[model samples]
Target: MTGGDEPAPARVQAKVGAAVLAGIGPRGAEGTDGARPHSDGGAGARSRSEETVDVRFPFEGTVGLWELLDDMAAAPRLVVGDERVRAFLVDVGRRLRAPEVARRHPELASLGFFLRRSELERAAGPLPGAAGSLPGAAGSLPGAAGSLPGAAGVGGAGEFVRVPRGLVFHVAPANVDTVFVYSWALSALMGNRNVVRLSARAGGTAQAILTIMRDALDDADPVVARTQRIVSYGHPRPGARRIPVEPPHKQLEHASPGHHASSDHHQGEHSGKPPRTSPVTHPEPVAPADAGSGGAAGPTAVLSAACDLRVIWGGDRTVNEIRRHPLAPHARDLTFPDRSSFAVIRARAWLEATPATRETVADGFAIDAYWFDQAACSSPGTVFWVGSPIECAMARDGFAACLAEAVARRGWTVDTAMAVEKRVAAYGLAADGVADAVEFHGNVLAQVILTSPGAAPRRWLGTGTFAHARIGSLDELADVVRRKDQTLTHFGFDRDELAGLARALGGRGVDRIVPIGNALGFHRVWDGVDLPAELSRVITVQ
Candidate 1:
């Protein structure tokens, strides 16, 4: 597809339809039959549906879970050295850098930059003579968690060499299509076989990334390339369900799922009361995974039983469903259940901002919230402004106007359902005496400034809708902090002081307090979990 003087293809990329899944391989007859759910997982497991999934590979092919897993079983585990992994991602970065290619998948463009040669080398830990770029090198962000009681030097000083967990299963969320790459890339770096279950509603961004990856790896890099598989199936919900998450690590054994079937919040934040608005009501009372099976949990159960590590990306409900399927005793899991995030700005900082500077700040915030249309857990759902009453009022109007313009510039897409949802949330908050004023970006988005924090938990909705509250001081934020509050983006705030506050004034909340602009910057150590470390085992040879 290049010009006359172009070089030969780097690797042969094939295009095949979804039916190609049939020809890859047959189900293994070993005790681990790829066709059915595990014995322990059959409690709530349902029969496999007769309909086929519309899954496909970008280089052009469709494959089923069994065939893909069989293909991987045939490949040996790769001993992924830092340089080789860096080389692979660099190649991928090069392809994404092409303007034509970059134009089509805008959502993934920034993600590609993280895999650039420079960023890859930096993230690989201390090079021969180079300094570490990120605070924790490869594990976590620099914060007080490092100094917590017995947690010092956890990933800091060690003699143990890391080894891959062998096979990784990723149940990616429907919200962000590109999230699978981050988890899959970490596992791949440790030389694991990966079967990623993307949302059945996955978009072109997912397909494009796989295409670049295939072309970059080709036949030459079988170690990394041959071990990867991407597939999706309709996530089943037999009876309208409410799910429970299995506690992580060794705790999975002692705990039963149904014990807290009535607990509404997964991370257990703001347990005051179910907001007057319930997203949807369950038709049937569903027991959490371990408690009872709803007889419709099939795909998740089958996939969970087959892998060594399962990285789930959906809301807690989805995680609760998947964990019900059960896992091999030796397998460990890390789940990124749903969490809420927000931003905090000092009124003095905003009041002092120049017109041009204000727009830049608005542009940055827009990027954070607009990337996934504020659907990501890291996206700021609320903005709490701390300052004098007069400064607070001005700050809200100025920032809202600037933010509205910036978001409009990005060509935000929101359907009629969401448009109505925002309006309802906006007016509902006003009626509930939660918001004093509301702003709109035409009919597509709404920004509500709350006079009281009460309505935020009750009516907070995302998809370009924002709710902000006025606070007299920073100390008030702690009262507003809920366990599920994830990221705190700030403008004109002290990172170290806030980090210390998160530790000293903690309510089991706020894992990350990043600069306003970088709230969405991917952290290798997310939710206090060292992903690379969690997916691998460390063996100490004395």
Candidate 2:
């Protein structure tokens, strides 16, 4: 929703130069276009059924890799003048999103939020500042001088690491479709030519995003050429379907030891079983040279002279897989878990607040929940209260009423209600004694639990549930903050209490503690440090 009466363009480019760096290509001449060039011995060539689309790379052969990278480094400067491209991109995002259709299908909504142009641009815009700052004091490096903002020239030396011309980048993750856009943009910004392996499930969104980038680049000013020329293809294997791995503490439930033990035993039995005395069983020893060369036979080695960067955004299994590769030590892995966060209110604030203030706080909670059905990390999965039992009860009632109203306004249906019931039933069985406290409202639910100040730090104020919201006391709030499982905890209190809680929680390992409603705002700095400083490589020429 645009905040003003004035008619603003439905879509505004969030970051002007950054998208070019992300490898979005220029809009091609009007017509269907073929794939770009690749150097991996035509490995990109693959057949696709009309009904089932398969992403294909444009280039073929080893030489194509270097050529593509060179092309990308030069792409930001190429200018194409096409007005249709932006509209086409919006249409692509809309079609791929199909928000209206998605709203009717409850199951699909759980995956994540389908953001509007304003939201996407808002998120994408801040990245450029991060993207432009390289680490290692590379900011002043000769070639790096002009790459970032406020550089002497229009375009400074590229700010990111320059992957020597022939490197191949392996991208693994599916949760955030726009993630690749960021990755490719980083590569382009760094002046590296890259080939992206997209998650299979993200094919549709990837196609749309890539198509838009390509069209936008076709008309980009030559100054932006250094940031284009990236290729994307969906990896055919289903290995990319894994959930993102959060830190161990954030895992949904503790992993079963039996699972690991059984796997180990199975491996041990296979390893310890005496060589079968039978000739048939002993006849299959392969030569070491043959094993080495044979395994390499499927695809030609396409290594660049420099180290390769394998970016992974998946769960434990995927992380382990990435770790197994010889280059794993050099890879950069960022994890995003299926996390649910929440807000906490100081009981006094609720009791002392005017009717309007109470309504404002409740409204904030409702807005957070409705944003993406409370499935996003930004959504408040629970609320903790620090007040008298009576106040807690009142707050609980107010929150529930607001949640129900919000759910009704969104038009939840029988099927959605049934799905919530099934989820509750399953959670009730898991939670057993704690199930009585859980409350459901159509597709949304709240679980209120009371705990004295002295409860064990590990004790949860509420049981586990998707999009679950909980309310508890401040003392109980401290306990939850101390737990390893909690990723985000927002404290709603006046300045003094906020500072005190921040200090206490800081000591206990809380990642972030912000005001209740402002928790959803974008954070340029994380962990009290600038993210750009941590993520970038700085080079100085002087």
Candidate 3:
């Protein structure tokens, strides 16, 4: 996929191997061996596991999970707002924005924008100094200087420094390929040593991301790789048979680390496998709190118990499953659980909008819903029209026309299998008497007019399916809002109006209420957590 004569995959593999091995040890001030004293006073180092993880970034190899943690612990300490980490992340972002790369994977373009040097600086918010506080960053960020309690370090009475939270272990979702990057980057930017566990089923966009990161490492300070790792390991599901473990060295001999664009699956696209008809009640088997190395839970238990913080990104089941592996007394958990979102439009405003404006809104909404196949937690599952009955009906019709045109323009389509699923879901909604009218515009768009605003479906109804309803006013939506609701993307709503609705809900649901197009945008503060502040601890001196 490279413009170069060398095959992209082979070129990436060779470059990563050479650059990583060369700087594997701590250099310059820390020590020749690249090992720094464990900041946890050796307790973190003592929790080693023979279980191995397949290192995907910085290098491609299998190393014992505990050994990998030890390497991270041995690396030089990174202060909050570390320059080396910023420079490396900025370089990676720039490359991600390259015309060729962005054109190939448009989603990466958004990710690249999030990683821009300007964005990073804004997220770091002038560091710990005279400023001593963060400005309100984009996307409802917390404007606090310090949040986490003192983990270590001290200064003169009333003077203190913000320090890394030490080791952070991230368990990324099997779906959503690029999300792990945002989580890991935020932690790394805070100067914490981070280990991101990428799923084995992670799509090709993830592989491309790893390759790009490896390429950036050539110019990065050795400490960048020493303190950060992105690895993938197999964790068996409940009732699955155990596979024999292979020795690390033997596995490395055949390991391949490179771009695999040909294998790229659209992020959030359903695997060809049949969809599950019911919610998974049984937790995925994980190691018990005391499980030793070599079993499914071994790695999870060790990483969970050893890390200073654990970030879990997935559905409710995932959160419950990971919770089975206990963390240390001092460690904490930041979780993103199952969430539903919707779009809100003032019916009269939508109807009054000029054709061009309506078209633009439709286009933006299409990108948000279609990009992730309407399955992402932020993707709008329903459209709530606010107005009198007559205006609402007219506006809904206009919106359906515009949205149909927009979907066609983007050429978003579902396969025969998914199309069947969408039809089944739409009919099921009608049979349940929640849908008053069901309409389909080819396989790319389906609209269900809900019998009432309270009947809006929160669960996904296949890609491009939208359950729409009308309410007399924005205030009426409060009764319909549920705790599982997350993002509320709006068009033609003033800040005061949206904020009032949020206040009315009273933190019952909907953590993010943004413009329609920005549903997928990554923010430093997500799901009500101020990441930069949460990832670092503030030490105050008496």
Candidate 4:
């Protein structure tokens, strides 16, 4: 989903060293249901005693939960930006870009473009924060397949060596299905073995994506399936009781049912030992206390305690709910919380734009607003016009007309429930004296005239409902911007003007300030945080 108050939110080869670390067989073979065998050689088939979990992508059908995690941990480790993984993702992107798929799911097309080799490489290249290294920087190591061509190694003090953060657990948002792909893809690109949790109600776009990925996996190296997984399970009700954990012994048992008790320093970097020749063996699977109940041993809890990182999406409520499930001491979270956005247009610019250009802008605005039903955190909920009162009123009227036409042209409509919701919200604002006028164009669009710029509503107001207010200058909005404000999409503004507004805000709010059409464009740096930098950790190797 394009980021509002509430937003919904591959493959590798095997080396002997990797094989040993991964505890898998040398040859690639099929497992039950046509899925590839587990990294534990062919044990993947025999281990399927219970099919409780749904493996949605790369493979489908239920599998024994423990078997899945064991395979993930045992899979051959990948250097950041491993070529095999890159190739697999690129293949999926190619499939997504197919005209038929794009026509059906425009969002998927955007995702396809984001997954392009060029874009991936660029993101995997030099990143913010780290003194020297970035995700995919493993290429700088000796004998590693170059992750980034022409990238340099750590040179001196202040330089660092970057490596994958190990198993990453992603909790994807329900409303925006494709979001999980982006979160998991980047983490995987950085060589992190991933387990993504999709909503049980994931939409068709997500299903289509899973199919593309599974198809791409067919020809990918066996390591791909061994390392990555997409699973969907029922979320335990809120306030579910937490599992009680015992203190760890020398070997820490992950708080998952059937998880093997293993030493902490499994990675070569920590162990400082040569890779073992034979696959690492494990003890028999033991069910945790409260295994079947929504307690500590539940899938979410198990994943939380087992992962090195947890990427959370949804909003404040989801973040808080997941936080109840404690993470391993070494694991941490990267959260995307509730945020709202607004649009800004210069009255002069709106009036001066060519009819075609104005139409195009309106169409783009419709996309930003309607793509996710304006429930995404990035969806613009209000419009700020800069001009005299008379000019602002004229521009508002003209823009409304164009926007309505654009919405109709795009066939975007709000159902009766949403339409009624918009009316209630709009009328409530008017009754409160915050909005002087409320207008609706059929069931597709609604406009509310705010009493003042400060009166802009931050909460969602149903799809296509936009609050309008005028300001004398762009700087005037700085006073109204709050920490919860995220994206500020605009038109008829020069770089200097936009930059000035951002500077004026001085990081108080509005992390992203882009042109209206690009409001929903996903980037490596989101919410002012460099994702590539955040996903990977740096070892200060002076």
Candidate 5:
């Protein structure tokens, strides 16, 4: 039987190369699921069984430190002023978003990736002008660096840190793809030749992005050379995944499933899992001893000491966990937690009695419920008032109706909605007391639990993407702000009342208070003082 002409060996090699370049591994290999095979492979039952090898480029120990610094210095200037380079970087970012790339590497969506692109774009762009500069283009950096064409600047430049040759970075945190990027990018940016021991789960994005960048830069370009030697590998040994016990918050997301299971099994086993042999390094570890002799070392010190800078982003749990570490005494880190954010209403003072006020209030409430699907800390978790009880109650009703309608129309599914409903239903079945009323629609649920004039900061209600809101007397709302757990509190009050509320919360250790929706967009300096400080060092050129 004459078989259809078989492809020549050269054609097969070319096909194999294309598949490999596309990030497709051999069939039956881990991570190959969702991968598309090359067209040449065409329903063939007899394709060659190829073994995949991870690409590695080692950093030589003999490279001189001064040579490294020279290379490092070139990166900032090349990246900052060059439009071509910025576009190239964006191209790399787009490549990361490709399905073939994203499925093979999940870190494209990481904060690290966001930070890398942000920092790279910022470096390529103009530096920020001094504070209080004029309104127009007179400010050197775009009103906001890396902002889409007309957006305002997010914050000032991130501090740049240079790592000398021969040092290594032990990157932790698989959940956050960008954490790896921060470490890897710093090593590349600073001209430090280094190794990145990838978190087993999320190294693909980091690996792919680095590969693309390394391939794109010219050999003679200092930035390219500095970044070229960086390498990524899983923990050399399988059992090496140990994170030091610092703040419980720092370890919360990275906590091992084994550790969690044990915690459940043993109930009181405070000593869950021993630190993995891997020396769990982060941009911020423990803060320095000098910040304060007591209390946990802030986020900045810990992260700065490890690499050059650390970039942290998440909720209150992350911030609190880092704060609770014993190393909190020695590490400096930065944190961007959901402090307080709010929505504003600029209607006329007399509008509270008019229909326009109801429309405005409804718009604000709808924003609070649906914006960013409520995951953003900036989404108003609470509301404030200036009008009489009648006005406030009317606003609340309008807000509730708007929110319910939005939920129904959009079919948004919330995480805690179902659980709350079940809990409320169970309570009704078992007890004689009046249960806190909760509303549910699919996965979106809203619950209103009455409290004494001021009970604990209202437990933010909602399941997945919903929020728990409280309608309280202004005095009672102020009292809620004083509680230790109320972070990122946004208030919607008259402009005059804002400063007073800010000062009141500031005294109680609250971090930020802003017009609600604006909370998610600002990138303030020393906001949390974790990553930026941790990843950078002060160099006084004598």
Candidate 6:
């Protein structure tokens, strides 16, 4: 059976070393992990004896649940201690950081770094989100992680206890398979049981990671295993729908970063239209609400209803659609909705770079663009080269060539569909006079178009689709910035210039600005929020 209909009968079997005992085909009763008969010493002992349950795998198949979950009622059954959580992350990091592991699984590279004990310490620094401010305050300020009026660590902030939000539901994106792990890590650290919903179109990476997690975590810490459930089942079609780029023929403009164009009815300035007037494009692909209800409403309904925190990641449309559904009164929502990002390279810097420097820049930028095939939210889709039209073009073209070579050496596979899409979009823009010229690499390499500032689009450019625009100076970018413009990958620019740009945007522009090649690096404080702090509740003892 494809699952999702009803709970099946319990299965029992003994496990032998690293071998998969096949399921007994539909309610036939099959396998076991050597669980003893559990008893509560009550009249309900018979019902409580069978604790293991079959849970659907987040990628392709299903696994028994015998784990803990909070159905939005009482507290979570299993509580993972901080030490246990840290140990699990360490184990995952050790495995992922292995040379052979990295060679076979490049997708999990960032996860390794993120889970590294030393790295995690640096990112957390004793207390990850301990600020002398109230919760929900200071969110407007960039890098301003909100925290209670105390610190949390081995010796400090003892009065302030970070309480888990019970159960967290993670709806991870398909393009980046490891994202779910990143999201889950924070909640797990806070001792929250999690149920991550991977994309129905999950790649093999999800399965591979899950298998390793199963092997390493089984019985090592019952709290870790029994508290978390990584699940995936058929979700509605993706590509068939998308977060709309703009509303019909209207083109919304952005002024400097310090200021915003206000429209009372506008949904988001980035989308280029007022919400009331903008059309909802994707409606057929509903979220998985209640599979137990026989495909009623949305498959996520049951999960959402039972969860205390819902971390939604996908596109803007998905975020908005999910918001339409109500959450538990005590629940909270954090969404990594559709966002666009770009890179800003100083032409003089690139043009004046020594041969070795140029090659290194190419390699770094290549990592940013090529990793995740540019499908990640952090990947820069448009590059604004700051310099004269002639010089900028020269720098852009040179960088493209160097990047192509690097990508080939790295053996980066281009998404054929996205490549074709880039070609059509570039040529289409040129034909419409929006782009001055079109650049296409038949090598399945990359595409960069020469266009005016703000002419570069956020959507439509998938994997290899890149856009370029000439800017006379840094100030020109202010007019082209959007509300959702996330990362500003730059080179040849000093701290002052970048800070000035951030100030000019009034803190409404890029939430993160990194060196040219570090665009895709994950941060503990992402999208302008302290994740660990935001995911947990800080009770002020005072």
In terms of lDDT, the best-performing candidate is 3
Poorly placed runs, candidate 6 (over 4 Å):
1-81, 124-159, 235-284, 287-298, 413-418
| TM-score attained by model 3 | 0.79
Candidate 5 C-alpha lDDT tens digits along 252-296? 334342332111222122122111112112223222221222221
lDDT of 6 by residue, 251-350 (tens): 1122122221221211122121101111112222343332223212233543554467889887887887666545555777998977788999999899
Tens digits of lDDT, candidate 1, 160-253: 4445677788877766667888777767665677777766555446556665665565423444545666665554422313222221111223
Which 10 consecutive positions of candidate 1 have the poorest summed lDDT? 10-19
What are the lDDT figures for the candidates, one per model? 0.59, 0.37, 0.71, 0.69, 0.36, 0.59
Cα lDDT for residue 194, model 1? 77
**Best to worst by lDDT, what's the order?**
3, 4, 6, 1, 2, 5
When superposed on Cα atoms, how far off is each prediction in RMSD?
14.5, 18.5, 11.4, 15.5, 19.2, 16.5
Q: Could you give me the TM-score of model 5 versus the true structure?
A: 0.46
TM-score-better candidate, 2 vs 3: 3
Instruction: Please provide, for model 4 over 512-539, each residue's C-alpha lDDT reduced to its tens digit, 9 standing for 90 to 100.
Output: 9988888778887788877776777666
Alpha-carbon lDDT of model 2: 0.37
- Model 2 residue 501 distance off true place after TM-score fit, in angstroms: 2.6
C-alpha lDDT of candidate 6 relative to the true structure: 0.59
- Model 1's number of clashes is 1
TM-score winner between candidates 4 and 6:
4
TM-score to true structure, per model: 0.72, 0.53, 0.79, 0.77, 0.46, 0.73
For candidate 5, what's the RMSD?
19.2
* lDDT score for candidate 1 against the true structure: 0.59
